[model samples]
Target: MPMSSKTMNMLEGLVKDSSFKWLLGKQSSFDEEIEEMGRSPSAGTNWIPELSPVANVVVRRCSKILGVSANDLRDSFKQEASESLKQPSLFARNFLEYCCFRALSLSVGVTGHLADKKFRRLTFDMMVVWEVPAVASQALLSVEEDATVSLEAFSRIAPAVPIIADVIICENLFGMLTSSTGGRLQFSVYDKYLCGLERAIKKMRTQSESSLLSGVRPKKEKILEIDGTVTTQPVLEHVGMSTWPGRLILTDHSLYFEALKVVSYDKPKRYDLSEDLKQIVKPELTGPWGTRLFDKAVSYKSISLTSGDGVPGA
Candidate 1:
């Protein structure tokens, strides 16, 4: 349903008070159009023309860059800038950012956003410069001047060229070329930079692997009888001087003490706490429930074992 007169008035008032107030600066295209509308009332019932000068320019440039029609570009921009009623400046910024992206799309001949690219490419301070070796420069110049490089592939390869400069820079061929290129090698210094990057990545991978292996500690097997079905469960074992940090298992046949360690190459040393010598020092202990539910509560346990009698040493 169309907006009622009262609702329309309220919306118009909101737009006039918020965005329109900011848009009507000292002198603008809108003001000029308003003056023109007053001068020529018979020109059209609408005050603004079908195509404003600014819109026309944006449409033509953006369409040409994207290989689309001016009409299509205008329609797309209008659809994207629908938020103009709420915040006109926000719509303006969106249009400008889109135009900037379109310019990049034109240069690379790829019509897509940064998220579409396979490799990472970031513009710092809106400036991207690379000093290539004479050989690399010659290789770049050999390509057809009209050809455009894919932005997706350019990060791994070369921008506006087919050469894989990143991979080439890591090769011994680059070192040989640099040595022969005289003092120009200093200006064309990419090998050492790439080598440093390679070393950093290798070191990161090594540390990651070390951390992963370090967490793989020794595990002890326990036989469980659940619903008359026997199942073997692997319980993670630890090794440390303090027994407070590790798990203390008490079975009908035996009492076991497993030490916790940061890294374990062999089976964890078990100190036998004799079942006969075991006693419930504290009958029951209280703690917070693991599930943290109001209905449930966790149990704390304390068991002391006499080591002087016949307890097997670790």
Candidate 2:
């Protein structure tokens, strides 16, 4: 179901609040305090009230947005008592992550909402919170403060792009994130990627309507990855004793390799990845004349293709 207008207004108000902004910026943790509550004599004591003032407000707001009781949301943070006692700080941090992840997942379903400045900033703040969920004695600093996120955090909140183009695999996502932000994803870089991905999908859709490959690509096929740059890194296809430099493209259903000619690319040869061909893909070495001198290639063998034929290694 779509989020109600009232809920959107509530979220906007929450984000605009000075205290909430301070909470996100500071990332204060009350883990030690919460842990002390766990040791109270009263059994089943409500621990939500013991959270830091801003955190308490955030949790209550999230509960309201999720249409659940505040206690219900608190109970969702399940951990063995022994474990929580041993690593209370870690447990507290993880609980914060859980709440933010659930809330953001619901709010970011619409791509158009991502264009909203408040929504964008809120999403980035969530990423910042994930990095350091609690107050620390010693601060952890990056090139950009509260601006970088790990791959795991990015995957949790990133809007699904398969609706636009192809299913994003972890390997491809990692490559894009690392290439742009040098292993830690920055908000600006991430936002740019989302905008570029939307434009690329639209452009590809228009091109596919009249392109020669329209007859070749199967119905519902979405391009996953394409590498053909000669200036940076050229893709090379190894077949038996001959090595052919080419452009390689992977889709949901198949792999296409178009060998590079003098100035133009040869007709793309399809390698079916979705077929029941008992395909095997693994890392292998490649060099000149079938010499395995460099461990920088992947070998692909299927019932249809000869064992000597290998996919592009770049």
Candidate 3:
């Protein structure tokens, strides 16, 4: 649905007033921070406090429409509905104008169901992506987590709605997955970098008795970049969790397993996205918004376990 100026204004007021800061503590304050930034030195400005007005608008509208009210909208809705239903010939006027509260409740359900069907294809498209992109690219947006916020917004509006999402992906894009060997090797590489052996060994490798290479890929090693391959990846049937559109709208561990396979690693029963580098690699994974779904992948050097990141997940 198209947004109304009134709705935007309402959100602007909330942004200006520090509303909904708890949902995204720092993120919710972006408007104020930007306003303050405009008056200060430009260097090292805080960005968490400066979200795009468009994102704020989107969040505001979604929250309202999905019933994730940060204000008195719900009571207002009930009052307005009650007052309006008392009018003459409302039910006979048609579905929208139907008088009974039950009718209105059912209408919300039907509307949500209808919307799920309309966007079901895109949901499937996003779900097909096996892993989050190293970064978002046109071919494979790094789990394409944007769908999570939007879908969560949808659920807020229609809590009963099912939002089916498949793991989305293509060839040219997939997240980095280091093997146990890779981890072991990075330590060797880092140790070399820390000392004088890195450059010495490189020179030696080029002009030595044997034409062999040793050590590991850097934690910052780039994944596929040359080929612009865009194709569908096979889907996994299930995981520890069942298919709950509303739940997957927040996070899908099944897809994470598929992504683990993308890096040729097995999915840990639990994963952690915030762990620091273990043997060599640092921990970091895409959030659902970027993955186009809800799920935050966390990892550490020796292990990974997925847990609550405050954005619903298995």
Badly placed stretches (over 4 Å) of model 3 are 1-50, 67-112, 115-163, 166-314
State residue 138's C-alpha deviation in candidate 2, in Å.
23
Candidates 1 and 2 compared: the better one by TM-score is 2
User: How would the candidate models be sorted by lDDT, starting from the highest?
Assistant: 2, 1, 3
- For every candidate structure, what is the RMSD over all alpha carbons to the true structure, in angstroms? 24.7, 11.4, 24.2
lDDT per residue (tens digit) for residues 1-314 in model 3:
23345534534454454434435554422344323433333212111111233232222333334454312332344466665543433311211111112222443354333233323322222222211211122222112222222232222222222221112321111111113332211223222222342343344334311011112222342221111112132222222233211111001211122222343323223232334423222324333243424233322233232343222232
Poorest 10 consecutive residues by lDDT, candidate 2: 137-146
TM-score of each: 0.19, 0.45, 0.16
Candidate 2 has which clashing residue pairs, if any? 29-135
* CA lDDT, every model vs. true structure: 0.32, 0.56, 0.27
Score candidate 1 by lDDT: 0.32
What's the distance in Å from true for residue 294, model 3?
43
| Model 1 stretches with alpha carbons more than 4 Å out | 1-73, 85-91, 99-208, 211-314
Candidate 3 TM-score over all chains jointly: 0.16
